[model samples]
Target chain A: MNIPADLKYTKKHEWARVEGDLVYVGITEYAQNSLGDIVFVELPSVGDIITSGEAFGVVESVKAASDIYSSLSGIVKEVNNELIDHPERINQNPYDSWMMAIEPSKASELEVLLDASAYEKLCLEEA
Target chain B: MKKTPLYQAHYDMGGKIIDFGGWALPVQYSGVLDEHNHVRNKAGLFDVSHMGEIMVRGTEASLYIQRLITNDISQIKDNQIVYTPMCYCDGGVVDDLLVYKFNDKKYLLVVNAANTEKDYLWMQENLKEEAEIQNISDEFAQIAIQGPKSETILQKLTRCQLEKLSFYSFQNNVNLDGIKALVSRTGYTGEDGFEIYVSPTEALELWRKLLEAGKKEEIVPAGLGARDILRFEAGLPLYGQEISQDISPLEARLGSFVKFDKGEFNGKEALLKQREQGVVRKLVGIEMIHRGIPRYNYRVQFNNKDIGFITTGNHSPALGKDIGLALIAREYAQIGNKIEVIIREKKSEAIIIQLPFLQKKYKK
Candidate 1:
């Protein structure tokens, strides 16, 4: 699993890149690999709000559908409309394919997110 | 979880194992969509050893089968197979299985893996003095080579005149290189293929050998995930979803398989009454008009009223669209009827289309 050291991740397999008060979020490589051949990705609207640890959308594969959770509480600033037509892009390159951009409501919550090392350890333990 | 005889082979192939109805089995190998397309264009081998097998023998075997299943087993000759549904007294499906007749006094039943014990017990309860039933699942293993290229690929393994074997027919003890096995021209995938049954001991060897023999044909090892999608696109009935304890053959749109003219059988009285009165619900196909995909057990609405629920839904790799099977009120079961599928609390647009999603390429 490729966990970019520069970004932050969550135990739920979501990753966030912090830039000022704006955070670009997407499912991690581990999440995309676990979900093979992603057929559809349902994402929240551009201005929708999502609380930390709450399910904001779904990512469906050939086998089953799974909920994608938000890492930090925020109002969505941008939604990756590209995923609606080409969800397989996430499987091809998860880290680069950000799903949403959020304006953090609780900016301090980003600190609570797991670092790459911690997230990798959590994935190993779960596996 | 229970393990099939070929479990180790699946592990070695880097299969993604999942607990399927208490059995530890591979849900995918390369991937579901990849394997699915492989089976459609080339060929794919599947380890179906987890499926249950039961032997029925004695002079009353033929007589007993007439009362046990909805299809007429007598229509099939020796070395032939018949697909049928076993039902409860209330006309609900107990299970759907393939019955292979070796002779008038002997038969083999291939049932769903999870329903083995329950089906065996049900058989015993209905068994007669001369008829006997035995759960021989652990004693045997099964594998299928399915796709358009399956016949040519499998022909290289066995000297049997496979070209002479018609669909739904089997030959017992055909030597595949050296392994003594029963090869049948039957499969779940809508493709011209063969299902091979052999002793559990030879399972892994046979699996490896078949994969090796079909290497040139691009036959990949498929798992439950791809198999499910293949069968779904073929318009086959799944036990729990399409038909179950509360769903009858009629409601499931498998009424043609129920042979009321063949004489009394399990669920005959109730089914006959149901036939006379007409089914209140009917199973139909749905194609999404909205962006979202519908899923299993999702609510279906007609005129904003909860009319039914989706049995199974998936993105058809072939058709490149979202399709599903739904059992709903008969009044709303007509083709071209528009409906709403509740996907994550939001209503999505869908329309009833002709079943099967696409033309089946079975015989070719």
Candidate 2:
């Protein structure tokens, strides 16, 4: 439910924090809460190229598995290797546990994503 | 979706609800890990009222039940429970159920909730004579208190001598706070536990009473998620996952319950032929040697050739490892054999181990 004013989000519940050329991405609190007790997180490699609106990885819970879609097309600069061993960190603090850092091909792509208030409204509708 | 008798109780306890086979049931009250660990170490209560209960009563009830199920009903004494699979004529499992024998004239069959109607129709179609069958699923509600401390928590309410109830046995007409009920020393979790069957009206009262009595001991209310993980760790076969209409009981490593020496049953001929000819595919345990969680329906391969698929897979909380049960070709189902589970189009290395990923602590 914590939607920071500075962050942008997608319909798939992924959040992006744009900083210069890099965007740190992770799932929102609503996503983690919906998918309870995350046991395993599949992350893309650091140098892997990912396309926008496509599934880059998977997040598995005790009951089912869900796909983690990329918000914008980018080259993964850094992947959070910590999530491989401790995936429950997302449940504790989803915004802080960023999955990967990507250098987006077009920074203007952020404008198409939902802002804090719009994203909050979307989450409310989903609930 | 159908709601159980304890649905309001679950809502009050902050249970996260989900749709499970058309039943609106709680998947967890607390988190899955906490609830699962509590059931392994301490006592955890579960509302299993969604399970179907059928009554077969008549002068020839015992003989009729013996002809339908795979287990030896004649060998079990009164008030004893026998676990067995009811199969079709082709040896494919119709459903796996527990037979609770009260006497020669009456017996109770507990079956999976999703397969209740199908099983009932099948039983009706095959009915010869003498025995009367009725669906009594809505008449009773079941609650399971599982763990090492289960008896300690439940004994505070009922005057029944739980110590006298051996494993796979039950006591009828037990006084549970002035309400007559049946208490069985059996559970799906691989722990010492008791499954109590009571009237639908008494379900909420009993659940609240048990929770209140075990509050000091930190007993939590678990849901279907923990129930699934516990059963998986115990290597118990689930109907849809382990044994289905497409999967035979013999291929599921449940041949011992087929009781071939006793007499003829529904699938006896096909099962006997299978036993004699040898099973082609076998269910085996697989542990991930690579960095991926094998999930249900994931393709399995041996040396790049597709052998089979994973039936049930998950991250085992008890063993702290990723494990799964896969039905693979018999040649690749050996212990220590190397294989790969295809997860999201990627093949991850895995090894075939024993059936149970964790050792069971059931009170035999």
Candidate 3:
């Protein structure tokens, strides 16, 4: 529910923080809350090519496991290794817990995402 | 819509409300794992008032129950409880319920929340003319205080000597802060606990009092989400998933609870025949050998042939891996057998293994 204004969101409930050519990717608060307490996070491997809308990893909770979709097309440059042991960090701070960093194939792909307000409205409509 | 007495408390505690079997209730609060671990290591409170309580009283109550149930009532003593499955004529389980004998003429049947109305109607239609039946779910609220610290916390609030009550035993008319309650040493989670049945109006006060007494242990308010994971970890069978009207008790591997040797019940003949002839299909545990999580209705493939389907599927919080219960052909249900779970179009390899992936700690 906490949609920060500067971030962009995907219909799949992933969020991207554009920092020039480097984009930080993680599941949104809505996704984290929906998934419940994250017990395990399967981070995308570094240097793996990720396609937009394609599932690259999995986020596991006690009750269910959800596929983590890539919001943008890119090659994974880094991942939050901290989440391997303490996946609950995503539940605590979804915005702060970046799952992976992708070096963009085309920075313009970010344009396809919904802004904070539009994403919030989309979530409301889905509910 | 059906509402529990603690609906307001659930809303106040930030519960994600959902409609389950016409009852609007909390699916999760805080988070599932947080509440789950709380109950495992510390303590957690659950509002299970949505569960049905049916009272059978009269001289013929015992005889009526004996005929309706598969378990032998003669084996259960007064103040004792037995968990058994009520079945249809074909040996398919209608529901798994707990039968508690309060006294010579009094008995309580605790059934799943979703099947309350259906179960009540079934009893009414099948009972002999001398029996009296009453659906008392609305009249009472049931609260479960489960965990290692559950007994000590509950003991502080009630006058009854909690130590005297052994597992599956109950004490009636126990005074709890002036209100009368029935405290039973029984719980779904494989833990030391008590399930209290009290007047709906007194539920909030009892919840508050227990919370106050369990303050040192940080007793959390758990929802159905935590309850599911806890029960799964304990390898307990869930009604809709592991057991259903289409699934027989023999197929579900719940033979221990099915008294085939006992006197005639609805499903006695079929179950006995199945037992004598040998069962063809059985429910078994499957752990993922690949990356994907197996889910319900997923096809279980072995040797390129469809053998079974997953019943209950989830990532085990305690095991840190994907696990599920599958009803597979008897030939494919052996331990260490290789199988494939079709998770979303792609097939993932899984290993046929024994259940309770994480060993249960029943708080001995």
Per-prediction TM-score: 0.98, 0.98, 0.91
Candidate 2 per-residue lDDT over residues B78-170, each given as its tens digit: 999999999999999999999999998999999999999999999999888699999999999999999999998988887788988999999
Worst 10 residues of 3 chain B by lDDT: B355-364
The DockQ score of candidate 3 comes to 0.54
lDDT per residue (tens digit) for residues B1-364 in model 1: 9888999999999999999999899999998999999999999999888889999999989989889999999888999999999999999988999999999999999999989999999999998749888898988899999999998988888899898999999999999989999999999888889999999999899999989999999999999999888888888989999999999999998888999999889999999999999998999999999987778899999889999999999999989999999999999999999999999888999999998876777662
Where is model 2 more than 4 Å wrong at Cα?
none
Tell me which residue pairs clash in candidate 1: none
lDDT tens digits, residue span A19-124, model 3: 8768898888888878877776778889999997788878877667688888688899888999887888998899999989999887678778899999999999
Better candidate by TM-score, 1 or 3: 1
Q: Which stretches of candidate 1 lie over 4 Å from their true place?
A: none
User: How big is the RMSD of model 3?
Assistant: 2.7
Q: Give the TM-score (vs. native) of candidate 2.
A: 0.98
